[model samples]
Target: MLDAAVFQGLSWNLLDDFRQLFTYPFMVNALEAGTIVAVMAGVTGWFMVLRRQAFAGHTLSVIAFPGAAAAGWAGVPLALGYFGFCGAGALVLAAIAGTRRSLGAESAAIGSLQALALALGFVFVSLSHSILTGLDSLLFGTFLGITRSQVLVLLVVAVATVAVTAFAARPLFFASVDSDVARASGVPVRLLGLGFLLVLGLSVAETSQITGALLVFALLVTPAATAHRLTPRPWLGLTLAVALALAVTWAGLALAYFSIYPVGFYVTSLSFGVYVLVRIVTR
Candidate 1:
């Protein structure tokens, strides 16, 4: 967990700035990891936004905090905790929703889960009894020290997520817009809901690695939301969402490569800027 986001600054020339993006192995790894995360998050988040589950997405992001903190405390791999706890959280939310509760009730359950997750994260940090040096990275993220192995892991998970999401896209879309109609049509609405929740959890966990737990929405929601505002067509919106995600990610890397700021900040800022611009233009 390296806190340093960049090893050098730009040379103030076009070619030099581009060259700086790959001047180091760490930077190259960071770009690779970011690209995988952006694509995965973009596709999954498009569905998440459509389902109006931003709260659930946010809760899962919070859920990743305890997972990562506890893993660091216990000296295990952080990715294990990230995916495990987020998956558990998603299942819990799905179960609560499965009860056929009202939207208000489901929201209450999700809020409670978020609170518990935060408390658990604090407990893990306190119980560690030492400075959690990677604390900043856990919350704010940094792209300075990612390894090739980590990049490979991201690539595998991203590919799986995109593949499954694409395979189920039609029914998932139908279910998301009108579950009652989709169910009436024998689309297995309940099962699709469960599967999508798991996919959301997986995307959050992966995006959390780059944007950090607190900032997962930077990649997961903003790009998708922006695309939704721009297009009514599903496939086009999804493609645009992924394209925006890549833009923010690559631009952030380039900017962070020439500055002392963390890549997360640049990413979040760029994403927000784009989203705001879209809102204004669409208004």
Candidate 2:
């Protein structure tokens, strides 16, 4: 009888805590944006890990720094700069990788590009005195001040990204798994590669709004990496990745609400913890 009473009390407390998360307007907007970002990151990051393009994804993330910084300096929407520059950076990375086709050469080219991007980002920060004002938010993210309009933008981008990814899933999967064989078997290998990179760019830009530029790997890589460690099948891995991302996002937001820490720190810590736990369990 005592155990049953204790269990009931615990369950009610948990329910109340959950309800508290949605009690605020800003919290609702944050969750909505976080959900969209998590889904997009999970799907795109799964393929990114499969294709061994984590480097390319990281490069796009680095480019996001300058993109957001430039936008703040120019008084334009941060999303516009994020998508514009990341899309352009993806083009450059794709063009370079296409030309070289060697691991060493490609790594060197990407490293060079990353360096230049960081340098330019600093320049923008210096140019826009106000850029540093919210620099922490650009690097580490915040759940506060999320507007309804931002949530709407995230929904639109998420739908478009998911749709394009679904349309190209079959061929993209084939090419990702075995490009040479897929190409010989009539897959549009090159076009699919470019299309996937573009989609990745879009997802990265959208994710940056939530997790910030430097910490994008928290959502984009960790959950996908954890799911891959947990499963080999594509559908199962994709579902698990999305689930893990959403879990971390909600938990992070909740924990941040009760503390003085930044949401990104909680998110990244939760994501890394789950990834490590999965690695240990799988091993």
Model 2: lDDT of residue 232:
94
Candidate 2 stretches greater than 4 Å from native? 1-14
- Which candidate should be chosen as best, given lDDT against the real structure? 1
lDDT score, candidate 1: 0.89
lDDT of each: 0.89, 0.88
Per-residue CA lDDT of candidate 1, range 201-265, in tens?
98988888888899898999999999999999999999999999999999988888777777889
Q: List the residue pairs that clash in candidate 1.
A: none
lDDT, candidate 2, equals: 0.88
What is candidate 2's lDDT per residue for 81-181, written digit by digit as tens?
A: 89998999989988987895789989989999999999998899889987633988888887777889888888998899899998988899999998899
